[model samples]
Target: MPIDPERARLLFQVISSCYERRSLILTTNIEFSKWGTILGDEKLAAATIDRIVHHGRLVEFGGESKRMGDSLMLGRQ
Candidate 1:
């Protein structure tokens, strides 16, 4: 699902304002490359990614979703 444009812009501005001077931890399934699609602006996405990547460590976990696993187990029960 795509993020709301106004919310995305608000989040972008908040992140920009708080860049480097504070700590932020964002967990998202969306890749930085696709942030433009989510945020509705490639330029804003790039800038947001630049700020985040500059200070944050990228940790990716590859596997099936935990929620999916739980749902499957529940269905079987």
Candidate 2:
């Protein structure tokens, strides 16, 4: 699906203004490598990644869903 140009513009604008002024926390299942596919614009995706990653810290967490696990365990009990 194509991305909304207006929304993309505004999002980039906001991210630009936040540069070095504050911290940005974003949670997503989408990996950085596939951002272009999601954003629907290579240039926009690259710029977005550039702005966010320039002094950014990357932390990754991996595991099965705790909620799902809990639900399954409870069902068994």
* Best model number under lDDT: 1
Runs in model 2 deviating more than 4 A are 71-77
TM-score of each: 0.81, 0.79
- Residue pairs in candidate 1 whose N, alpha carbon or C atoms collide under 3 angstroms: none
lDDT of 1: 0.87
Write model 2 residue lDDT over 13-72, tens digit each, in one string: 888889889889877778878878777778988899899999898888889777767786
Error of 1 at 18 (Å): 1.4
* Backbone collisions counted per model: 0, 0
lDDT of each: 0.87, 0.81
Question: CA shift at 58, candidate 2, in angstroms?
Answer: 1.0
Superposed model 1: Cα runs more than 4 Å off? 73-77
Give per-residue lDDT, candidate 1, residue 18: 82
